[model samples]
Target chain A: MTGRLRALAIVLGLAALLIATVLADAARRRAARDAEASHRLLVRVIRLPDLALSSSSRWLRHPSQAEPGAALADLPAGLDVDPAGALIGPPRAVLEAGRSR
Target chain B: MRRQLALLDYAVGALGRRAGKSAALGAGLAFVVALFGAALLLTDAIRAEHERLVEEMPDLTVQRLVAGRPALIAESFADELRGLPAVRAVEPRVWGYYFFAALEANVTIVGTERADPALDAALAHGRLPREGAEVAIGEDLADHLGLRVGDAMGIPLDGDIVFSPVVGTFGGGSAIRSADLVVARPAHARRLLDVEEGWATDLAVDLTTEDEARVITRRITERLPGARVLERRLLRRTYELTFDARGGLLAFLLVPALAAFLLLAWERLSGLGDAERREIGILKAIGWATADVLAARVYESLVLSLTGAAVGIALAYAYVFWLGAPGLWGALLGWSNLRPALDLAPALDPLQALSLLGAVVVPFVAVGVVPAWRAATLDPDRAMRGAE
Candidate 1:
């Protein structure tokens, strides 16, 4: 009798755990669906570097014209100091160059 | 039923009495479960995010390779790709990494030949840059830099400083890789990245039919020797491979801990103490059947396994969803700074979770069986005498 009771307890406990797992998994699946939907919307709506404007205004505000005045002359090759005080350098190599400086 | 309830109650008391031993076993099991479960959850989240982003990715990416390194491709190459069959459109994309020295972050600078396609690209702000003088920033970047629409943002280029109007910030939907993105018009991107005129970072090819991806890849290769082609369909596999490798490395690091736990478990089960042996004998001497004794042992194992698993899983959930997975994130997904907006919703696959639980429980319960049976079948008198 005691043996049967202990066995039953073990089975019941396992069943409980499995039930919990299933419920949690269901909730997780719903969350995943919701997240993916939102993510799709986000990616489409907030695209970067609208090419129409990305290049046309590289220097609307020169760094040299800042209140404190940026030092544009110190920049090296593969980089351009736009009028807007933003440094546009070649991909990672220019970044490396800047880091070394 | 009453006797079974009593047995469970007794087993609980027994574990309580051996608190040190039980705690060690339970804690080890919990830690293992947490580690495995958390890794699986985080990987799933990362994969989901990647899948969402990949929908917008062009069918193929064609880039120029010079001396086995990526160099800018000419505008002519885009025209070449457009000439191919089933090739719908070829877009020359200008993108590069821009390091923000102040924040120690690398921003993705993308140059586009087309205009912001949407009526309101920055829906939150309901505007795109008005002219070449303006640029759009990702919401996270704007937050980090304390930028708002109309803020004049400046960047340092080689030998120059360029300031652009921050026309808008994009965010508040599903977190994409927009946090560190700086989108500008094509000309601005070219000048900023210093790609010479007539060259682009790469060409994004849209195919009329995806079934011809391999064929297009071959054709592009033949026409443009030394051009690297990336197919969008295969990106998921690449991401999966990367994530698997990182997960494997994490699992490998847990080997020592698991080994220690195994050793401890073996000593506790295979090397039973005299007191435990005598107690089993006392039960048998008192006319308790071998099956009853076995049941008690099984109950103990089940209780331990279930308690440990439950605690571990609960902790894993909290660790991943609530705490945001501190150590694991840095190790698994920490490569580039152009990171997707991290929104790891608590997601679990039933099959995967169940399999992990089974992996933890089955062996644990089975291992205890042999020692339990051995203890129970002993001659009651002999066990009582403490001779065996």
Candidate 2:
């Protein structure tokens, strides 16, 4: 009777330990995946550089000018500019460069 | 001594016959535990999905306000933003809210330039809105309106005027909040909103450093007052809080169920009375030690717990995964059909299973210990006299 009881105890203890291990492992994996997904998202958000307006005189809003002062500098690479802003930069730059020539 | 061995042999045979039935009961209980554990896992998965979507959203979204009313941020502002030293990509997004009185539905029209990649990835059907008049509805909106790709639904603009041609549909992650989005080109949105030179919204300034997010936000606030700049982490937390109230209610519901399980296990183990007590005494009198008596009872209790817990956890997983946490949002908030945004993996791996086993087995073992110890230490002479 004692030997039978001892055998039962060993079996039950091992089974209980197995169940606990499975639950904990599942939880740990879920947490790790969540952390990885969050990190990926943060990386995407932080990759872009800050954009600044050009400081060229041609595009400056001069108070004395007849029209609202426009920045005549070239639009930065890979940027899309509205049609109105596109016309001023090339001509203004040419005029300024010619003065130096 | 031989007579005592025969009784022990008979008891062992009886246990063998009963073992099958006990195993079946344990299996049923294990299924329930597995279901419960699965539901818990599914909840975690849905939250993770929400976090992923929130993280993908722009770091700082800038919208223009005029006289406390929203105005377009000039198209040139995108260029202006692009030129800033701290700015990375200044993507202009055009959007406006539309109210459909007949359907009592409110929808937002979002427009993006063909050059923008973010808008492109969100598309679910048809090509991007190429012309100034075409639009793409969100999947939920499409379903509700019974509109499909190449289907035309008139969009009402200001002054009771309406625009025609719903060209496509798109799908997004958040079912709770993003159900009514309609996508179009920036020009189309601008026309609908009557804004000629600017955007309804602009996602500006991707900073290089984490610390710089605060600095850049301050600069933008100083430069363009009244604009809101939200960091990605803050936005993710905001979305998480949307489910916080629901989670509290779920916790409350689980507490009673857990208590009931513990009580049921305790009663089942404790119900053995004098006949069983005598049987235990008879075995102990023949030289069985306290450890042996305790071991058998503990073993029996552990088996019952493992079965019950496994079944419960499995049932919970099915409820969460297949049926989608039914009666959850409705019970918490009067909203039915709140589809969780993320896919949850609800499997009881080795560790979780072990934890659950411990939760059940430990208490029952402790309860059985005292009774087993008393039976084991009983003197054979006294026990026999008392039995007679």
Candidate 3:
């Protein structure tokens, strides 16, 4: 009976340890993946203004003098640009002037 | 009455003999209780240390925001902030997060004036990082990364890579906050992060009293329209939330310690045979009240619980301080050379001790009370005959 009890205790202890280990690994993996995604998002967002500034030349020479549809299309995935928004007003003005030409 | 007292004395003495089953039970109970106490003490000590570290941070912080995003305040803002009546010291700092390849971890890089007294006080080793590429890392980070003074670390910064020489290390009480912090010159952090003439972070004004934080914060908010000003206490509370988020993992790690304790308690209780039950019944049958039997059992449980708690606390201290439980440090703390921070001073106060005692005793009593009461209320004749 004592031997059996000892064996049972050992098994229970091992099971508990295994469960804890698996949970910790899962949490670590989840955190790592989330961190990677957040890092990628930040990098993508910060690069947007630079992309907009560089793409202005192509639209400026067009005779229509309207914001080029391709300029808006070049925006990164999941980013929406509203021409009427105040935050992007200055940049939109440049685009509008190019479209008017 | 005299015979009963003698029987009690005999029962106590029987616990001392190596051949006696009572002795084995007593020893096992004592061992388990000791471990329990140690665990409580160690956990409390770690908690107390964390609290102390949070208290030591600046009372108010004024940081600059760029386009609603956080950016380093310019050094010029320090001059503007210093002139304010409510402001104490405008400690302009440059700090950013960077990854270190050798450690395979991200570290916070802090840049401050080396001559500044407040910043200098935090240094634990050789000297503050003087040159552009020189760095001073946190004590916990250095230990984990196996870094020493003069070791060149490759710092991955935004738009640039820099090899910074580690000149020193310093300890902070918090495990989460203190880990992997590198201190450097303001120019270094600015150049690395590719921010021209801008500080990355600002710790505004150390106030005379904590009460002045809100007023000062409001003043700063009014002054710098886009800047974020936070009271130090509020910032600490935010850090505390982060700490608590990780606490679930720490609590999970303690399951083994708790399970061992419950099993020991169960084993001790299960060992009280029918013979002992009949003896207890006989006492009740003669003249002993239910309250008296209950009181004695409670006293016994109290003895075991208190002993266990005390021992556990001591063992935990030894594990953290003297002997150092290397296994626990690695598994739980994620760092091996973690010494108990100076801020951590866990006292054996009556309230804390009592709480530990209550935690152990109340649960055990809840489990044992009904069985003990049933044993005490059994008919003495039937108990003696070993009948159900």
Candidate 4:
């Protein structure tokens, strides 16, 4: 009976912690939402379309705002693998196979 | 229901009997969970912030392409774009990267007309950039150079050095946008960035209607053969792809470690020790059914896995949101030496959390129980003898 009670307590404790984490995250979301207006104003004042990642190249730092054609060309020389291509490879393969058939 | 509780009780006590081994397994599992959980949390928060903030981004940005490289477009380009039917306003922007040789880092310098009223809210100290060569800088930049208001620093521009005064520092909600940034007037920016007076970096064009983006983009491309137009939707897609690719890469790197841990777990659980085998034999001899014995093993696995996952997730949340994810931040964000204080908005996706827990727990419970099942179904006498 003691062991069973202890087991019940452990399970309840874990569940409570999970609930607390969720509630905390909710509170943080609310806080971020409240500050949205100020961030918007900053964006207008700064006049930049992307985050300040502070990389060597503008294309690397501001991928979203970079010239679309130049962005692909300006990737760091050693990093030959295309991240987007790598991610979509399997799905693209399946689609190509279907099309070929 | 009552029988299940009795089985759970036995499982808990049994785990306690082998406290060292159980604790080691729990600790290892928790670390793996925490690593993956932190990466997910940070990625989600950054993506959410990007999406939220991008609502204010300009409709279209026009840049001149010189041999496939982005070059300065004429200030007159804004005037030409303003004449378009769908164009509402066009602002010529001046901004460029400045390489600081001493620190071996690049600083982004932007040219603004004057201090916008919106800036007063983000200013940590002093006044905005006004008068000759006065500049407002980001907090991280200020900290790196150890510059305060009323201080002057000489910036090396071309063969000559241009000395500028630190008029103000930006902080608070603006840190993410302004870190490693320097804002100066167009004249000062042109002199420092070496951009010609009549030329601007690019044109930020705002459209009358969001639906007109496609039409304007087509017109702009037609008008300027060498022009590269960046639409807001394309920018949003770029951000999504960047974050997803980075997150996916990190998760991929962790796959081998996860697989090794799973293998280790299988080895430890499946190769049941002599004492464990004998204990299972005694339970079966005492009229405990194979189902009862199997139930106890499943309960033990559940208890360990759930507890480890909960603790790991809690640690990850605190690591990311509270402590700012110390060691992991620099590696993930690709920052070296000086880094902005990453104040990410906290985010927790319940579905993501459940999937992570399920990924760990299901394999663990299966690996742990299958061997216990074999032991439970064995003849009681044979099992005891085999163990001896």
Candidate 5:
């Protein structure tokens, strides 16, 4: 094959390899689905919100578990904003919007 | 097919001539793709984990509101729900966060409701607590407090200290679920959390059928005027929204970077150098159709983009799944002192990857072809002269 054809082949091959890696990773995860059973039991035993975002304030750490009425009671610490903080409006807007119910 | 291959060959050769520019474009594109791909994948994985964790949550959680803040509810409320139709059980739970001044972090203390074999199976180091004074703590908490099984730790509540021996520690797949958790007997938990007698944190309502959850939620609200009934589905929805919003915010913050990438790609493709102009002129003079010239340019763009995207995606996958997403994890999830293991289950959707590729390649190819089209229509002689 010419140099140009060789280059094309290499590019295509690289792409295929990457996609195969992803698929293989997915398969590994599927095989480990039983691992989640323990997590389910843990959840039932102690029904705290997810620990993924617990590194911040109590309200921000467990937004789903936090009181909804106090959603905008305090300002989030700088750079400690969790996803729940973003989904809930900012404090000023939340106050201005008032109660919806 | 032969004609297309010939065009592709020419495009590859041309790219080789401008190797430096091609490499720069490819690297920039790869970085942008990696950022977006990793964010998308991490968000989806975390969401899936949340769903799995919440799957076993109670059908409805009832909390009392005292001036818009969560306060302890009377255990009598559980009795009110127990008599409702299709209601299976109403469990009054005792749980709250205890601020440990030693680490300046709050640890969750959950009171176990019953003696179950499942709790024993979930422990990584030892068995569940058999007594009120014995407790099970999370792995992170255990590590921080330097406590092992049979070791006692002091938790201060209201100027007094309550000591509980660590009977077990939670780890492995359940690490994310119990990273800052402490499981204790109901009496010990209430003492550690300073809860008053006859009051509980919340009521977990289980139903015979999940279909009755909405109706039960309504009845609970009507019967208990100041109660906040949180359904499992609503909590799941909140988790889903939180993940989506987190990922979306990260992507939004990178908008300027994406725009810069687009500008760079457009400049590289549209602002062809003298050599490129002359090459196109020669091709046109040699009876290469305008369509042929454009096809060759499109091919060049495709080759670079496809290669860049593939490399970026692979790097992203390794960065998140293998490397544990060092810097990006804290950024996507909250940067907390006590964080879950985040051993997120890998979930790569083919459609999501395809959409990312399309988001990058479609605009790139379009940018490349427009400039090539403009240059292709030039007079052959003027083009050979390297005219703009």
Candidate 6:
């Protein structure tokens, strides 16, 4: 290819690539946000209360069988998930009265 | 200096002769520069905004951590805080997430019955919400919800809905205030959330002085176990660290791509094929001084790299300030959905840009010199014969 023509091609390619990268990134971010909304909608709003109620009744029927936190036994509340002692906000958040929070 | 300038002119002509390679390399490098520089500057601007907001934030906020989760605190905590010497006022703030089923997104609902001096300072278009069941929302929220001043807003309640009168809509100096914010009286918020008379989401403590934040926080935790105390300074630090960590992650992700570009650039500039080496040899055979040869090569590198840096810096400005950085801003802020149309103030200094340019220019010039010099020093007769 001629030098000027090759240069034009490279410029066009670079512009296209950058534009594509930006659009794709934006789309991916939007999809991610939508996914998060759906997750929150499903878990927090739709099914959580029903699940809690169902679990509450199950334990009530079998009163003899109970955990230390009896109400918690029915509360699946991440029974399938591992609970970690990770605080959500600032690391400097007070952990104790005189310590970090 | 005159001689160097002449060689630089010659270098420009020479680069023009190889316009295809030069344009390709320069443009690609510019793209890389734009990506990295934009990320740095955007991160800086957002960090600055966070710092500004933190300055206005209350000194200390105390939250209840019940069963390893945040829950409501009793109003009785306010009396406990009033005993502290440094404490000026303890406000039991009633604020929580309200899932706007219509919008299908969460909007923060804040309620303060008292005359908030802070809100008054920022009160631009209208007054703060005064009476019970009165709400002063953000202008954007007002527009989105299709509500006007004096219009009543119907909030969904248990079996029956409660309507609150829209007293005012805030604008100007409200960048930190989200468009989805719904500010109301504490009584209305309590009624909306079904919170009992003595319950609150958290307590906001206004200290007599800034220095007393930590001491008062310590006292609060001592008085109340499982209470999380957040200081504005600490929150500011957290924001700085979070942005820094995100920038670090971005840099890490881009390293491979950056390295690949550098490698390709090095190979192109330093790796001379047979014809190019012969041309260098002919220049040497024709009695060109070693310094002159080196100057020409260095000038060529400078032209391309500097152009790249300049283009990069310009693009970065447009991205962060004008177009709002499309996908990148969301990544930096971690708020995917709620990024309204924001015109970010660029916090980039000329010195910072120059420093970045210096860092970029050095590598290009340094990398090109060695190979060009090596070719220049070749034995004249052998070089002409293509006998490297």
Q: What is the lDDT for B103 in model 4?
A: 49
Residue-wise C-alpha lDDT for candidate 5, range B133-193, written one tens digit per residue: 8999888888888999989987765566678888889888778777888898898888777
Off by over 4 Å in 1: A1-38, A41-97, B1-24, B113-126, B172-176, B270-275, B286-292, B331-342
Q: In candidate 1, how many Å is residue A92 off?
A: 16
Model 3 lDDT per residue over B186-239, tens place: 788776655677444665466667887887777778878877665556644543
Ranking by DockQ: 5, 4, 1, 2, 6, 3
Q: Model 3 — interface RMS deviation?
A: 20.2
TM-score per candidate for chain A alone: 0.34, 0.36, 0.36, 0.47, 0.53, 0.37
Q: Best to worst by TM-score, what's the order? A: 5, 4, 1, 6, 2, 3
- Each prediction's number of clashing residue pairs: 38, 67, 16, 0, 2, 6
Q: Write the per-residue lDDT of candidate 2 for residues B70-168, one digit (tens) a residue.
A: 455766766766766667676766555454443344455556655234434445556557776787665666776688887777655554545547765
Better of 1 and 2 by DockQ: 1
Residue B79, model 6, lDDT: 94
Candidate 3 whole-model C-alpha lDDT, 0 to 1: 0.50
Candidate 1 on B1-388: residue-level lDDT in tens? 8788777777776776687988788888888888877777777665554554565667887877776556788988888788889999988878776767655566667665444445353335636554585677777777777888888787877656789888767665433445666767777777777778888887888899999999999999999998777777775565556446555655666667656766667677877778888888999988888988888788888888877877787778777766767776544333333343345555566787887778777777767767768888888777777665
- TM, every model: 0.77, 0.63, 0.62, 0.88, 0.91, 0.73
The Cα error of candidate 1 at residue B109, in Å, is 0.4
Candidates, ranked, lDDT: 5, 4, 1, 6, 2, 3
Worst 10 residues of 3 chain B by lDDT: B334-343
Per-candidate iRMSD: 12.7, 20.2, 20.2, 11.7, 8.2, 17.3
For all the predictions, what are the DockQ values? Answer: 0.07, 0.03, 0.02, 0.16, 0.27, 0.03
Backbone clashes in model 5, listed as residue pairs: A55-B336, A55-B337
Model 2 ranges off by over 4 Å: A1-101, B1-35, B53-55, B63-83, B96-108, B115-124, B156-164, B171-179, B190-199, B236-249, B329-388
